[model samples]
Target: MYTLYIANKNYSSWSLRPWIMMRELELLFEEKLMPFGNGSNWDSFRKFAPAGKVPCLHDGESVMWDSLAIIEYLADRHRGVWPEDAKAKIWARCAAAEMHSGFTNLRSTCPMHVGLRIRLKAISPELQAELDRLNELWCEGLNRFGGPFLAGEKFTAVDAFFAPVVFRIQTYGLSMNTQASAYVKRMLALPTMQQWQTEALREKWREQGHEKAVLAAGDVLEDKRMQP
Candidate 1:
């Protein structure tokens, strides 16, 4: 049996990657949520997570850490986790890897928070550059691969990697071009993504560090998305 250990649904972008991939690919796995900053949970998480990070996957005796690593491991074991076509697969992997390593500015400036809505006081030039690159990348993939999803007609790991970006954009009310905005809407509409968002809303645990950073940047207003 495959088991996935994750952190808070509201704040852990890394955790969201593999969780969404497994769910969208219809892979059956036991989910273990470890709320970080909790002493007991952190200690328990360290027992399995090699880097002491969340989103670790346990497959029998093997423990896989890192979101991209876990996704690649599952893709090797199962079909449809990634695109089948060689060219499409290459582009998808490139995009996913880029997401894994790049976009530090966007990640630092606009953290993922499904449960909170914040209006950013400003978008720095660095963040704007990252957003522009992201929009271009998404547009290129959709145009090149002919997608309703990132890689093709069906959802793949590429989409899963960017799932948190969808939440980031929504939470901060960031703007993108027409195609990018449409893609974000499509991602938000996925049943698996919706499930994560609902669970995130129900989670009361907050990472004080993340909360402080977000509060310092912008005002936390009512969740307009939830308001009737």
Candidate 2:
């Protein structure tokens, strides 16, 4: 059995990546939720996660501290972590890797807040460049590999990597090209996505740090979260 450590679904974008991938892969595992604590969770998370990050995976005595590492670890042991087709597998890895490292602007400007619908005051140039790249990359994958998942017919790691972006788009009501929009709709419609959002809404703990980013991004139109 594997144990996965995570943080708040509403705010932890990195945590969502592997957490959703594991669920979609139907890999049996236990989830440990450690919501962001007051001040830094650095000391606390360092207990189980080496670098004090969520989405840490414990496979018996061995531990994988990074999301991409865990994804690859599962890919080694599981059958469908990445696409099986040669070209598709290559593309999936590259796309997922790109997502792992790139898109800093989107990640920072539009932090994941699943329970709120926000209307942004403005999209900064940095964010706009990233968004343009995002749409282009997504369209390239969908056109080359065929949809409803990036890199193929299956919802593999690439889709999981972009899952948080789906929520961000939903939160800020961001626009994309037609194909990318359809991809977002498809991803949002996933059963796993629905489950993740529902749990996120039910969470009442509001970490001020995450809230600060939300306010910086835009006006909160609707908050689906439970009231205090």
Q: Which candidate is the best by TM-score?
A: 2
Model 2 global lDDT (CA atoms, 0 to 1): 0.92
Candidate 1 segments exceeding 4 Å error: 38-42, 223-228
lDDT (Cα, 0-100) at 71 in candidate 2: 92
The whole-model C-alpha lDDT of candidate 1 against the native structure comes to 0.89
The per-residue C-alpha lDDT of model 1 at residue 160 equals 92
Which residue pairs in candidate 1 have backbone atoms (N, alpha carbon, C) closer than 3 angstroms, thus clashing? none
Error of 2 at 181 (Å): 0.5
Candidate with best lDDT: 2
Worst 10 residues of 1 by lDDT: 219-228
Q: Write the per-residue lDDT of candidate 2 for residues 1-228, one digit (tens) a residue.
A: 999999999899889989999999898999999999978999999999999989799999999988899999998999988988899889888988898999998888888899999999999899999889999989988988887789889999999999999999999999999999999999999999999999999998999989998999889999989987
